[model samples]
Target: MARENKRKAAEKAEEGDEFTGREDKRPRKEKVQPSQIKNKEKRSAVYAKLKHEKQVEKRKKIKARDAAFKQAIELGEEPAQKMVPRTIENTREADETVIRPNDEEFLAGNDADEFSTVLKQQTVPKVLITTCRYNSSRGPAFIKELLSAIPNAHYYKRGTYELKKIVEYANNMEFTSVIVVHTNRREPDALLIIGLPDGPTAHFRLSNLVLRKDIKNHGNPTSHKPELVLNNFTTRLGNRIGRMIQSLFPQDPNFRGRRVVTFHNQRDFIFFRHHRYIFEVKEKKGDPKDKKSKALKEKTPKKVIARLQECGPRFTLKLVSLQHGTFDSKGGEFEWVHKADMDTSRRRFFI
Candidate 1:
């Protein structure tokens, strides 16, 4: 420690803090702690074990291959041709037959000793997500990142919802997860369903709230009135939303799509994660003339940013809480009402 003191002492003295002990003392060697040495040994042991298992696994695979080859030879099967040219004997009119293996036979082929049954295997769910913005862009980009973290994930353009040809896409693949992204304008509404992660279901409001809730994303349900942009959002989204959500399968909380919320497109809807609804963003579109309406509508863009930003943190808390509640599905869209079915009293708000 004398050398360490000497090294530091000069600098310390220059800096006006006195260094204790002899300036000429020899530097002590750093003590190698036993715990560090043990840790190195443990790491080496783990690596050695992993290497051994890999080698053993490689040997087992080779043995199985050799057994198959020998059995094939014993059964007088044709020898596999090496580097054969496909064009040599191939003809255009040859009928192709595809053979599907029997499930029982396939299961029988797996080594009984090995854990080869498909049941124990965990599958990452395939996800299809859409956002309010039609760009094969931000929403698609987020899905890519999500799929990177998962496996067997799929993504598509939100605009494809508009196409008549999209039925094939909808019918061909089964999505284990479907997500929609929407921006939060205020405390998000009652009807907003945030997906859960484990499977194809979700929670609304607080997962634990144990109450039925219906929401109007762009409209304030409490006020029983629509905000200016929220009303426009409702109308604009109403026509397209059913097509957008039709292909989506819902998932429970912990779903990946709802991971982030963006203010970038609040003027439109953001249906994030796996969901059945869309967000209706409310913004002050123009100068308000009336005192009460102007006071409510005239918040700065900065406040809007805060409201949207709070979406993620609050949603995460709600999801993590797993607030237990049951939702009874209400028929039809919130904005869609047929005059034939509506009571005259209820039609007052319809106009």
Candidate 2:
């Protein structure tokens, strides 16, 4: 060490001699130092980069593992996704974001829960009103009128064009029964499916109709409300009341209709209905047509009248009052259904 210091001092003196324009016989000392802070910083940066790279590799491996498990379950393997420890090599970590051990696995667990819940939830029957054709020369005015009367009714534009929308909407809500409306071929041309949800909701018949549009109007279609058009059936000549019971009301293995025992509608609430037995109709005090209703004043006792002589007791007609109220406040027998649950994973359903 002494020899080295002597040499370093001798080199500095020789530099001073050169400045004075004299010859010097000594070597100049090296100016660079062995312990500069800049060198230390460069070493630190390299170490940090290596650590961060290792951490990134670990996270990517974890992510891939989680995603595979999720896909396996979705493909019917039944096994589900799980998480495991993931390492990070970096010393400094960000505060806002946490690198999950297995993020995709966490999401998979949530998806499984949703699927389980949806499968168990009961599904209600829905009444569907679809026109085989729309945007015809005549407008859909009649359809509009009935929709006004029935709230939450499903309406669809024809074809597979709007089928996806139907499935999506049905997934989000429930239905009671489906009613399909079509044009009548005869003078009274209206097809209606009623009294559904009592059995399999698919059976409906157009055996009874008012008229044939072709026979009466000669293909001249008229724009009118369906209700008004149905009323025009009264002018028909033949009593062709072939409801096709076999086609419309099939034997159901699971359907037992619900009976309504009581109804409560008063001044406090507007959910009121006419209290009546069979063959009677008590018009509400506030309806516009109540003044013109002769049945309300007639007060006919409950009676059973057989429309056809060749019918059994089951086929006999019992004259009954038409119950009223917007929220199904009829005090009699009715059909009830549970809410419909559907799988929303790109599946198709009838609307």
Candidate 3:
């Protein structure tokens, strides 16, 4: 300790200044002024500017692609394929059989009448809703929500039966459609819609599926079915969601004893509701005088049944439009809908 003191005294004498015990301190960080914070107007303006710039850039790229494709075609070279922001290109060659003399005469005839006749003969759809065998909690809740929207649907919990066997059962029992929910990260995030009796299957990604009980609703039973209506559902996104919902039901809506199902999207949330029509005969005001009077009294007025039950744990989907006709994370023109902004309430707004 004495040697250190002597060294310090010597160093102080050489520098001609007194030595302090404390080490040098770093400078304090400058505080941001009030002007540094961006206000609401400024933020909106900047966002609008950026959006405009992006749109301009996108148009430029599309024009360049069109020009290149045209040039290649003119030069007798095969044009490069592109699949994005558009439907898939038809790559199949024309079949010679379709153009044969026998087929040509038949093709020139009316086919719409046949399609209309078949449509008229279509029957009510019986649907089965299920989830992945491995999924329990999330899948069950999702299935329950869907069932509440479609009260007449049949449900089978996951794992009770094999997929192939279940499909066979549906075919035998004449179930019109089958809906399967898939879970990821302990949350339901996808759906599979299959038509009964060996038909096409469509896969859909269900995103941002938050339940009311998880967000605001408590342990109380939250079932109230309202007369659901889709308002201002006219955009491309709205049309796609509408089609997906429609595919869940049977082709025929005029089936006897079948309830009406409505699915409409405003903003991005798909709303569901069911309705049934009631037809009852009017009561006779006076005693029947003759056979004609009795027959007249039997006639009843037809009225739609009142739909007072309002039920839901409604959900919003994060639409991701994919390119290459695939739902994978990677591929095609993909985008997520931003519906988190509080300024616009999706539920209250129609479009």
Which one wins on TM-score? 3
Worst 10 residues of 2 by lDDT: 231-240
Candidate 1: segments with Cα more than 4 A from true spot:
1-124, 133-141, 160-171, 184-200, 203-317, 320-351
Summed backbone clashes in each candidate are: 24, 20, 9
The Cα error of candidate 3 at residue 63, in Å, is 43
Give the RMSD in angstroms, all C-alphas superposed, for model 1.
28.7
Return the TM-score for each candidate structure.
Answer: 0.21, 0.21, 0.40
Candidate 3 Cα RMSD after full superposition onto the native fold (Å)? 22.6
RMSD of each: 28.7, 32.6, 22.6
Can you write out model 2's per-residue Cα lDDT over 1-351, one digit (the tens) per residue?
A: 999999999888878897888876558787543344367877677667778999999999889878887888789785543544553322223332232445775445434431222223333224455553434332255455334323235676766444334433444554343344444442113333332322222222222221222122222212211111011111011001111111221122111211111112111111211111123344434546546457655664444532211100011111111111111323433322212352232221111
Model 3, runs deviating above 4 Å: 1-33, 36-121, 212-244, 247-310, 317-351
Q: Pick the lDDT winner.
A: 3
User: What is the Å distance of residue 217 in model 3 from its true position?
Assistant: 7.5
Candidate 3 worst ten-residue window by lDDT = 110-119
Model 3 scores a C-alpha lDDT of 0.54
Q: Give the alpha carbon lDDT tens digit for every residue of 146-208 in model 1.
A: 343233445565554642223234334644344444323322222222122222223222211
Candidates ranked, most accurate by TM-score first: 3, 1, 2
Evaluated at residue 219, the lDDT of candidate 3 is 25
